[model samples]
Target: MKKLFLSTITIFILIACSSAPTKKDEIKTVKVNAAIGEIEGLIEEDVYLFKGIPFAQPPVGELRWKAPRKLAPVSETIKAFSHKSKCTQPKENEFILDRGVTEGGEDCLYLNIFVPKGNVDISKNNYPIMFWIHGGSNIWGTGNSYDFSKLAESQKVVVITINYRLGPMGWFSSSHLRNTSEGDDRSSNFGHLDIIAALEWVQENGNSFGGDPTNVTIFGESAGGHNVLVLLATKKARGLFHKAISQSGYVSSFSEQFASEESELSSAKVFQDDIRFLTEDQQIADYLRDMPIKEVFQRYKQADESHLYSISPISIRDDIVIPKEGIYKALEDVDPSVVVVAGTNKDELNLWYLRSKYFYQTALNLGRNLKRSEENLKSWIKYRSNIWRFTGAEEPLRRMSKSNQNLYSFRFDWDEEASTILGDYPLFLGAAHGLEIPFISGDYSLVPAYARPLVFPNESKEGREYLSNLMMQYWANIAKYGDPNTFVQDHRWNKFRIQNQNYLRLDSPEYIQMVNDPVDADEMLKTLESDSTLELKERCLIGWIAEMNFVEEMRGDPPFDFCSEYTSIDLLKLRRLTEGRD
Candidate 1:
C-alpha cells in the first residue's frame, strides 16, 4: 500500500508537470536584448519571467574577495528560464529544497525579472519597476525564494529580484586587502557593491522588459531594507533608484578598524588570530581569498559571538560606499529628492525569540532557575520590538524628513486567525520578522508548510486577502508615482514630519489608516527603563541586538552603559543561554 501510494504520487506529479502550460501560441518566449546578450524568457501566468541573468562576472578564484566586475556585452541569444545557483550560505534545516530543485554555489550573482503582459505594445507602456532585495541577515536567502507572479500580474508592474554575495565572501575586509588595492577596490562592502552592480544592470536593461528605468523603486525587508537605507545615503547609488522602502530596516553601525579586536566581530577576523599573517600583505590577501568557501563559512560560524543575532555581514563606514559617520548622519547628506517608506512589524522580535535555540534555552534556564521564563521572554520580545520601531522606523524617518524629503512611516500590526496547533501561535510568532513578506507577495507558501494555516488561517482569509490587495496596490502605486496615496483614493497615508510624526497603521480587519504618534515612543522607553524584573544585563543584551550594527558615531550616546554590578560569570552564563549551550 505504501509503494502504491508512492507510485501514485509520482505519477500525479508527472501528469501535473506534463500538463503545465508552456510558451506556445500566446507569447511562448519573450525576447529582449540585455547587457550581454539577447535573452529569451517564458510567459507564465500572464507575465514574462526571466531568471538567472548574470549582471556581474562570478566572484570565484582570485576574484573571490574583490569587487564584482561588469559583464562584457555579447550579441548571442541566451535562454533565461532556469534560475542559477543560490550564493553559498549556511544550511537551513526547516525547508531544504532538493539539489535538483535549484542549484546553489559561489558562482551565484544573478537577477530575476517578472513583468506583467500588457495588451499595449512594450514601448508604449511604461510600467513602474519594483526591485526586491531578499533578506537573510546577508548570510542566507536568495532571489529565487520569492514568487512575484501574483504581485506582477495583479499590480501590472515589473518586479525584479537579485542575489548579492553573502557572509564573509560578500563583506569581508582586512587591512592587508585594503592596503594592497587601489581605487574603489579598496572598499570593504563587496555585497553593497554587488547590489550597485545589479542596480546598474537595471538602469541599462530594465526598459527592455516594459519597465521605466527612470521611475524604479528599490525596496527590501530586513537586511535588504538595511541595504536600501545604505543606497539612499550612498553617493555612488545616486540616480539609481528614485524611491525606497525599507521594511523593518535598521541602521546598525560597523567598527572602523576592520581587523582589530577592539572592533565588533567582522568577517575579516572570523578566524580570530587562528590564521597566520605572512610577510607580504598581498600573500595574506591571496591566502584568505584562496581558502575554500565552505571553510571560510565554517570559520565565521564558529567565531560568531554576536549571540542570537546575525551581524557579521555588515557594511563598514569605510569612507567609500558608506560615509564615516554612518547611515544616520549619511541621511542628513542624502538627496532630499529621494523619498522613503520605512516601518517595522508589531512583533518583529518574536520570530527570533520563538525560533532561536539561544532564546529557547534562555527561556528554559529562566524556567528552571527563576520560574519567570515565559514572562521574561514576553517582556524581552516586547521591549526589543519597541526598540526596533524607534531605531529602524521612527528615528530614521525623523532624521530623513528633517532634510525636507517626503517620507512615510508605517507599523504593521496585522495578526489575525493564527493557528496554534503546534504551539501558542498568537503569543509566540504573532506578526514577526519576514511575516509581512507572504502578505505582500500573496504567497502563503513562503511561510513554513506547518505554519501556513497559522500565518493565513482559513477563518481570516477575507481579511487577509483584503490586506494583501491593499499592500499590493499601495506598493505598486508608490512605484508608479512617488506617493502610495496616488492610486489609493479612500485611504490617506500622511507624510511623515518632524512635528506631527504621522504614520500608517496596517491592520487586517481595518485595512490601513493614517494616524499620529500611534506608537508611544516615550512610554515604550520608560517601560524598558522602569521594568524592575529585567536585570541590567538582560536590558543591555536587548539594546545591543536592537542597535543592529554599531558604528563609531554612536560611541558617545551608546544604547546602554556598562553595568559594573554584573560579574563576568553572570554574563558568561547569559552568553551560554544565547549560544544555546545552556
Candidate 2:
C-alpha cells in the first residue's frame, strides 16, 4: 500500500555527515582571491575548508521564482567559516536520522569548497575540480549536509557542494511570472540556474584554490543525478562541465504547458485556485514576488498535502533552458566530448519495499515476518528494481550512446549487512537506494550510530573498507581522467554501447566484474508475466509500479493485460487497505 505513495513519500537522503571533524583550538586559516571576494578558509584534517560562499544573490522578494542572479564582487575578505542556512524545506520524518537541518531561510544560495592542503605549483599541476549536487527529490535537501573533506584530501581533488532553491521556490511555472520575466528569468528551473551560476563562479576562481576549472566534473545521486542529466541535455549548460556522473538518475521532464496550464494539478492552477482574489496577471506576479517566504512555503505545503504529487514539476522543457524535444532527445545531441557515467543500485527499490506492508509485516513485540515474507519480498524487489535500472540507468545510457561513445554504466550490489535480532537487514535493505553514498564519500560513519552495528558490523569492516576505498578511487579517477579504470587495477571497466552493453558490477572484491548483459523494459515485463512464482495480484502490483516509474513513451497501454481489470486508483486503494491506511 505504501508503494502507491512511493512517488510522493520516497525521499532520497543521499548525503549526510555524522559530525564535522574536530577543529584545533589554534586556528589555521588560508586565504584565496575568488571571483566573489577575498575568501578566508580554515585547514582541517589535511584539507582546506571554505564554507558558505554565496554564488548568487539570494532569491528573495522580487527575485522569487526568477533566475538566480550573480553576486557582485566584494572587497573585504569573506569569512567562510560556517555553512549557511539550508534551503527552505519541510521537516523530514523522525525515522530519518542525521538529515542535517530540516528547515531553513530563503537566503541559501551558498557553496562550500574542500581543497587538499598542500603547496602544489598551480601552473604545473592543478587538481581537477569535482562539483557535487545533493539529492532530496529536488524538494528537501541541503548541500551543507555533505562534507567532502575526505574525498578532496584523499583524492587530491577540489570538491565543491552548493545549495539551491527547493520545492515551489525553485521551480514554478505560471503565466503571470512568465509574462513579467525575460531571458533566463523566464526559466522555471531556478535551481538549475543556481548550479550553472556556481559553475561559472568555479570557472572564474577555481585556479585560486589550485583547481583546474577546465577539467570540472559534475556528479550527483538521485535528484542531483537527475539535474546532472538535465545539464547534459540542456544547451545552456554546454562547456560548464567537462564530465558528468549520474548515480541512479532518471530523465524525467515535464512539458511547459503541462506544468503551467493543462493539468488541474499544475503549478499555475494550484496557485490560482488558492489565491483567487488576484485577478490581473501583473497583480498576481507582483503579489507572488512580494509574498513572505513562510507564506510561500505554507502554500506549497498545503498544495502538496491536497494534491499528493510526488515532486513539483521540475526540469520543465523550456526552449531556453531545456530543449522542447525533451531530455532523452536532447541527450542524444549532447557534446560528444563530454564523458559520462550512469548507474543504479542493484536493489534500488528495496528501501521502499521493506517499508511497505505489502512486502513486510511487523508486530507489536514479535518483529517483522521475515521468514514468510522473504520469498515475495525478493521477487518483488528483483523485478521492480530491474525496472528502476532499466528506466534510470540502462535506457538513458542506451539513448546517449548514439552521440557520446564515452559513456559508462554501473550497478552497486554491496549487501554485507549484519543479521540482527530485530530482522535480517541484508535481506531487506540489501544495496538499497542511496547506500552507495558512503562508499563514494569514503565516510562509513554515515550509517546512523544506532543502526551502525546492524548495517555495518565489525565483522564486515575489512570488505567494507576495501569496497569503499575502491569506489572512491573509481570516482576520483573519473574526475581526473574521465575513466574509472584509469588508475584502478582491480577491473577494466568497459564503455557502455547499444551493441555491446557493458556495465561494472560494484560489490565486494570477488564479485566486482564487468557485465555485458542488456535487457529492455519489454523483456523484463515478459519475464515477470511468465514467472509462476508471482501471483496475479503480485503481477498487477508490479505492473502498476512500472507504469508509475517508467517514462511516458516506455509505458505500455495497460502495462500488463491482466492489470486492465484494475484501475490505478483501485490498486492504490487496495494497497492502502492492506497497509491499514484506508
Alpha carbon lDDT of each predicted model: 0.70, 0.76
- RMSD in Å for all candidates: 6.7, 3.9
TM-score of each: 0.85, 0.91
Task: Please count the clashing residue pairs in each candidate, in the order shown.
Answer: 7, 1
Clashes of 1: 7
- Model 1 sits at a Cα RMSD from the real structure of 6.7
How much is 352 displaced in model 2, in angstroms? Answer: 1.8
With candidate 2 superimposed using the best TM-score fit, by how many Å does residue 135's alpha carbon deviate from the native?
0.7
Candidate 2 C-alpha lDDT tens digits along 1-582: 011111222223233432333565566788887677799887777788888888889888888888888788999999888888888876655333212233777899999988897784332449999999988778777777776778888999999998988777777788788888789988878888888988998998888888999999999888888889989988888999999999887777778887787544466766666469778878889887787766666665565555322246777887878888888888888899999999988877766655456555666221345533466667877887787787678878888888989999999999998776767778777888788887888765555455567678888888888888888888889899988887677688888988888889999888999998775667777878767777776688777667666773333344677877786666655555332232
Off by over 4 Å in 1: 1-27, 93-103, 119-124, 258-277, 305-313, 356-377, 419-421, 518-525, 532-540, 543-563, 568-582
